[model samples]
Target: MTDGVPTWEEIARDHGRFLYAVAYRLSGNDDEAQDLVQESLIRVRRGLERYEPGSLEGWLARIVTNVFLDEMRRRKRRPTDALPDDPERVLPAAPAADEVYVGLSDDIQAALSALPEEFRVPVVMCDVADQSYEQIAEALGVPVGTVRSRLHRGRKLLREMLSEHAA
Candidate 1:
């Protein structure tokens, strides 16, 4: 935090978990979250000079979100084929037993992932990233009212989904 601007390493060391949590909430997949964090860091490094002093995490959240949206747009433009689910296909290796999983429950994660992007982004930004509606609105280029509306709708959807799952 020298000169009111953190070095790249300092940002990563201090805020990596925060970045990853936001990314994971947005993407709903570990691999995609990792990629989002990596891309966000790259963007942060490049844009550091122009970054203002207030709310570094907010800035990082915006970067990660933009990266996720860009990738979604790119995927839409050039959609990939899904491989057939074969019964005998080998699954990827599991995480180490000692590794901690500090995320939403599987059912909650699925419900959140099921949300449309318009709703999900606001929910993740407001809840997962702990960002203010004004900050989210500013980052998303939407009105604060819109952020509130979407967040409300998104939470409603999640509640319905989770209740159904519980039933």
Candidate 2:
């Protein structure tokens, strides 16, 4: 027990930035991401005592993801935001050759935000967060096959989105 907050609490506090990063990618909105992390903390506190030895970041990520999904299910619908017709208003000018990778990362993030939750969750866990397929399956309560399938499809979608931007 460090400072009376318990080991898990300390762990969560230490990894708060990582949690926020995962939440931001999943929710795609700063405020929604913040809310997800805040709400997940309650669940984390409850589950910490029983948490087995493994990746602490992965476990916290699972909790935050579940909380976000739960809230999404509760709402049953999300308000869609349409992009402006003006290209200038939507995207800035093209990047230089040296800055291509930087632009690619931004493009990928935008593409990721467009994916459905079914694909987004698995891809983020496997690709962005660097979790194994088995770990993602366990956290998502789905089979490893499902995780792989989702990841494959998600990557394909990302490639398509990126190519569209390139051309």
Candidate 3:
């Protein structure tokens, strides 16, 4: 056995469902859930050479968790304004006051997106990511108190948003 470890495909068949569950909770949607799991598997495969045999499952779990968070981080970034496929043509640049702002228009989506990054991060870490608050504290490089506060604030914000949206 290489490094005394089982093969990746074997372990994946055994554990893929568990990884999918983690992604499903974080994404709150089936399509994105599947994407998270697939991305996680890709990351695991990419880094396989560096993994220690004893840490196989742990490494895989971390990869899955990071993929979910990376999605959220990317969602927060401004989307590109350029249409990259047109290599031979270009449009005239707008004047000094023009700026493109692109994002979700629906109130519900906006509300979720508007939650403070700090609050949303801890809630997802503890709830959707299925990580212990202590683990979240370690991963976030923050005190447990900070994690607790963020989680509480996040839940409160969601409650308010949902109630408002339901009206």
Candidate 4:
């Protein structure tokens, strides 16, 4: 196995930064991005014994992608009180000062944020998160049936929300 620690460490040192960019896009913050990258390395390690040198980068990318998606699922599966329900939840938890004036029209991000965990996770995984249905199902530990249903419902809600503006 070619110096076990070096192989994994080498992989991480070489590719981890690139993967971290993808994680940050998925996670929306640096702290969570680093955590996801580190966790992705762990996952890649477990599968290393079966490593095919030809697809090493693909393998690493899959691990990074899955790790970020898994974090989204865990956040969704948590209790409702993961954040306070209060409207005045304050900045940081509330939108940042710049977001106060210069971000999305507020309504769209607000609508997305307001969606239930079941709908939100699937929607983000499909649209914004860009994870495949199979990947999403594996990360969320659910059937593909569940993923498709949730995605359909989530899209319908977003469509309705957007239509309100059209009307």
Candidate 5:
């Protein structure tokens, strides 16, 4: 805790990596993840005073998620052309671990990206961000049962997509 004011820079310094993880899992790209984190920081700064003490990480993750969802809504309203990309240009550097495992994560991200926003948000909140059903429900303004069903369906779809890619 620095002097009196809780600066966004301090929050970014402490929680940037976690924010990046959440953003990356949601957006599936480095640039979008960075933008999401940046936007979340801005929102956090505006609301920092009202921020409660417990689960700061959770609060930040929720902000990132909200920002991402808002962008998705805006994009839907103003559809843009998606430039075709060369596969080579899109691929990430190889990870240190098993190639198959790394590819699986990429596959999961692709599948997650393809899911409906409702399913995708809950699944990422519960599975990727490690939030509980109650937290996910609250963040999504839904019930626990709704969150559970969405997560279940999301995981099932992800499995099917990954298996098809493996074949």
Candidate 6:
């Protein structure tokens, strides 16, 4: 971190997992999360010169979110057809034998994915990314009150969905 600004390599090496976690929570899938991280890194490289020294993770989160929202908007404008689930298609490898299963986390993740984007983004930003309301509002270009409202509503929705599953 020279001059209080992280170099691109340093940022990637230090915050790679953090970036992936936030990306995964936002996108709800591994492939999209990987893409988001890659794109975010590219943007970081380009904008490194302009980056101010404060809340590096917050800046990265904002970049990841902007990339996600941009992709969402583009998809909405030009939707694509889903690929047919062909029997001949390759399947992902099963989890390793050493891995422990946690059912509740899966359920929570599914419920989160099911949320509407408006609610989901704030939820992930606050709960997963550990961003502040002001940071979230700045990243999302909304009022702080709106961020708080969406976070409350998003948590309520998640609780309801989880309760339904529990019952």
How well does each candidate superpose onto the true structure, as a TM-score?
0.86, 0.76, 0.57, 0.49, 0.80, 0.88
Q: What would the per-residue lDDT of candidate 4 be over residues 52-160, giving only the tens digit for each residue?
A: 6664554555677677666666767985634657665523455345435343445555556566667766676566545678877876679999999998988788778
Rank all candidate structures by their TM-score, best first, as comma-separated numbers. Answer: 6, 1, 5, 2, 3, 4
- Model 3 agreement with the true structure over 1-167: per-residue lDDT tens digits: 37665566766797787777556545544556678888887777677777777645445556766786776677657344333457643543342332222433244444645677677656756664567777777766789998898899888998798777677
For candidate 5, give the lDDT of residue 3: 42
Regions more than 4 Å wrong, model 5: 2-6, 80-101
Candidate 4 regions off by >4 Å?
A: 1-105
- 2 against 6, candidate with superior TM-score: 6
Question: Per-residue lDDT tens digits of candidate 2, residues 1-167?
Answer: 63333575686679888888788788776657778988888788778667776777778778888887887776666333334467675554454564345657777778989999999999888776778888899988999999999999998998899899999
In order, candidate lDDTs are 0.86, 0.79, 0.65, 0.67, 0.81, 0.88
- 1-167 per-residue lDDT for model 6 (tens digits): 78999999999999998899889888876767889999999999999999999988898989999999988998787665223256443464354553333999778778999999999999999988899999999989899999999999999999999999999
Candidate 5 lDDT, 60-139, residue by residue in tens:
87899899988888877766523325567455655435323455677888888888877888888887788888888888
Better of 1 and 3 by lDDT: 1
RMSD of each: 3.5, 6.5, 9.6, 6.3, 4.4, 2.9
What ranges in model 6 sit over 4 Å off? 81-101
Q: How high a TM-score does candidate 4 get?
A: 0.49
Worst 10 residues of 6 by lDDT: 81-90
Rank list by lDDT: 6, 1, 5, 2, 4, 3
Q: Which lDDT value does model 3 have at 141?
A: 72
46-143, model 1: which lDDT tens digit per residue? 99899989998889888999998888888778665223256443353364453335544777778989999999999999888889999999988999
Better by TM-score, candidate 4 or 1 = 1
Could you say which candidate leads in lDDT? 6
Backbone collisions counted per model: 0, 0, 0, 0, 0, 0
Q: Candidate 6 — what's its lDDT?
A: 0.88
* Least well predicted 10-residue stretch by lDDT in candidate 2: 76-85
